[model samples]
Target: MAFLKTIREVGKYFHDIYSGVASLMRGMKVTGSYFTRPGSIVTQRYPENRDTLKMFDNFKGELMLIHDENNLHSCNVCNTCARKCPNGSIEIIYKKVEGADGRSKKILDKYVYHLDTCSFCGLCVPACDELALKFDQKFEHAVFDKRKLTKVLNKPGSSSKTTNE
Candidate 1:
């Protein structure tokens, strides 16, 4: 009776081992099929075909200040974007300037954006309220010198040129 019980236990162990092997083989077969199918490869050459590539509509790329036809950006130097930036990459300096009506308005003296430290979060854009900021989809930002990555997106005193101009 003892020997008969030992044989039953061995049979059960072998059955379990066979089931595990069968499951493993099934998984391997799926992987093997994928390897043989050249059309199933999901990798794309990024730099070689950047023009054909498309980014998400909401993809956060880089922050830019939009200049209207009047050579002026809508940013009122509210500093809301600088405060809301999680990475502290945005620095806006406000300068008091007299408008054509002789009224002093807070204008942006300097808009410094450190692209290296920027998280590319769109939080700053909406926080602007004036719609002065936007995400530009130019992602070819790689540079040999890290310092070159820090840039001022807006040109000084030339913010009013329209796209046609």
Candidate 2:
């Protein structure tokens, strides 16, 4: 009975070794196929393919305000985007401006966007009911200084149409 138990243990050990070797060979086979099939490899050469490199439509890189040709933006300064931000990346500063009507309305003065703090969760875009916000595809946002990461999204001379107007 002891000799039979020893034989069973040896058989189990050999099976484990065989299973490991078979798994290793399977992985190596996949690697070998990739080497032979050049088209199967999707490794991109950076900088050289910059012009041809196409970003997907759904790719979320950074948030930017859409300013029209007339320098008119759709942001209503409702503070929805700032409030919806999970990381408090958006800081909006606005002052009351007299609209076409006699009453005063809040117009965007400064839209501070801290990129470093932003998690790129894409909450701010949908929070804007005006559809003024969008993700900018240009992903090269690296800067030498942390202060430089803070960006003002509202362009100069850009204003939104007042609801009362």
Best by TM-score: 2
- The models' CA-based lDDT, in order, is 0.78, 0.87
Please give, for residues 1-165, the per-residue lDDT of candidate 1 as tens digits: 999999999999999999999999999998888889978975665566777877886767778888766567676677899999999999886677676677776666688999999977678988977788899777787889999877776676754222112
Encode model 2's per-residue lDDT on 50-158: one tens digit a residue.
6877888878988899988888888888999999999999999989877676778888889999999999999999888889999977778888999999999988877
Residue pair clashes in candidate 2: none
Q: How many backbone clashes does candidate 1 have?
A: 1
- lDDT of model 1 at residue 115? 93
Indicate the worst ten consecutive residues by lDDT in candidate 1. 156-165
**Model 1 segments more than 4 A misplaced:** 42-48, 68-72, 94-97, 103-105, 138-144, 160-165
After TM-score superposition, the amount by which residue 47's alpha carbon in candidate 1 deviates from its true location, in angstroms, is: 6.5
- What TM-score should be assigned to candidate 2? 0.74
